[model samples]
Target: MKTLLSTNLIYSIMAKEAFVKEAADDILRLTEWIREVFEDGGKLLIFGNGGSAADAQHLAAEFVNRFLINRRPLPALALTTDTSILTSIANDFSYDLVFVKQIQALGKPEDLALGISTSGNSVNVVKAMETARAIGMKTVAFTGGTTRPGGDLAAVCDLVLNVPSDSTPHIQETHLWLEHVICEIVEKQMFGTT
Candidate 1:
């Protein structure tokens, strides 16, 4: 049991280290983009499917509700959070159109569209990014390693942050951490240390 615990801890540390080492530059780019968006009063629009959907909502909440600072709520929306819109779009158009439809409705040239997908190829996320780009919104994608479908979506976005791990668990863990760090940076930049 002791040996097993130690091995798991070592693996976790190694996984985190690999992610940080490979993705440090990408993380900084994301932080810079978020700061730019906030400075320009541009909103953030985020979406995904399943676990990625939850992650999208989590990230939006951090920006809209405050991450580590108490200040005015930032402009951020999780398209995945609205059951009515989701169902209506899924019913009228298609599941793949759900996010795209929302983007068409709410996105503007000054806004930012953030899509999260472990595989990077989620059709809905890709569609939304396409729509965002068509309308001149900046696109950001958080994806797993190079092999996943989500990586394709990352190709379309203005900036892509692909965590180094191919394993879903490790990828998702890194995604959560990256999201938290982004929120903290955005918050601090927006509101200062006070």
Candidate 2:
């Protein structure tokens, strides 16, 4: 048991380290873009499915509340948090339109949409990204290596942060780390705090 646990931990760490080298540029670009969005009074709309849904909410909360620096709340909404809206959209239209409907209702051209799917192929997430693009909003995707790198989600997104590993657990772990880093940087940059 101990050996298995240690192996998992080592694998996770090594996977993240490998991804970091390739993703540094994209991470910096994402951070700058987020800062610009906030500076322009634009909100962030984040959505996903399953574990990715939880991640979406987590990232949004960090942005809207605070990550490191204590300052004014930033504008961020997790489309995954409102069950009523999600259920309504899923029931009335299609499960695939859950995030898309929310985007149509709340997204502005200045806003940004982030879709997280470890598989890089959640239908709703992809649809949301496409919708965001159609509306002239920038879209970003967080995904893992799959049969196709980033799958359909990457095709529609303006920027794709594709984690190098195909393992969902490792992908999610790295994603969470990146999310936290983004929050810290964005907070510091916007609030002029360390």
Candidate 3:
């Protein structure tokens, strides 16, 4: 058991290392998108399910509050935050429309929509991205690498950060790291802070 645990630990780190190596350019591009949204005075609407939902909330908090800097709050919102809205939407329009309805109401062309899903195949997430595109809102996705036929959320998103791993916990870990990295870069660019 101990040996297996150690091996898994090494494997997870190696997976993240490989993903970061391959995705450095995309991550930087994502940082630019985030900076652009903030510079343009647009807010972000982020959402997901399960562990990804947690990531959405965590990342949004970092942005709307502070990540590592003491500058003004950036406008970012996690769509999963409001339980009342979520339950009401689910009841009135089905779970599929939960995010799409909200996006339809609050999203604008200048805003960025970020959808997080480990498998890149959440129907609701994909639907929301589609709606964002139709509305001219820039869309981003943080997902584990996807190979499913026609189930790839990346296909609809303007930017997709696919962490190269299948383990949900490992992928979530990488997602958190990438979010922090992006937040740090955005802060530096938007506030000129190190």
Number of the predicted model whose lDDT against the real structure is largest: 2
How close to the true structure is residue 139 of candidate 3, measured as C-alpha lDDT?
A: 92
Q: Which tens-of-lDDT digit does each residue in 1-194 have in candidate 2? A: 99999999998998789888888999989999999999999999999999999999999889888888778888999999889998988888899999999999999999999999998989999999999999999999999984687889878999999888988899999999999999988887888875
Which candidate comes out best when scored by TM-score?
2
Ranking by lDDT: 2, 3, 1
Q: Judged by lDDT relative to the true structure, which candidate is superior, 1 or 3?
A: 3
Worst 10-residue lDDT window for candidate 1 reads 146-155
Ten-residue segment with the worst summed lDDT in candidate 2?
146-155
- CA-RMSD of model 3: 1.6
For candidate 3, the per-residue lDDT at 179 reads 87
- Provide the overall lDDT of each model, using Cα atoms, as 2-decimal numbers: 0.85, 0.91, 0.87
For model 2 the local lDDT of residue 8 reads: 98
Model 1: pairs clashing at backbone N, Cα or C within 3 Å: 119-150, 120-149, 120-150, 121-149, 121-150
Q: Candidate 1 — which residues are off by over 4 angstroms? A: 1-9, 146-150
Better of 1 and 2 by lDDT: 2
Off by over 4 Å in 3: 149-151
Q: For model 1, state the Cα shift of residue 179 in Å.
A: 0.6
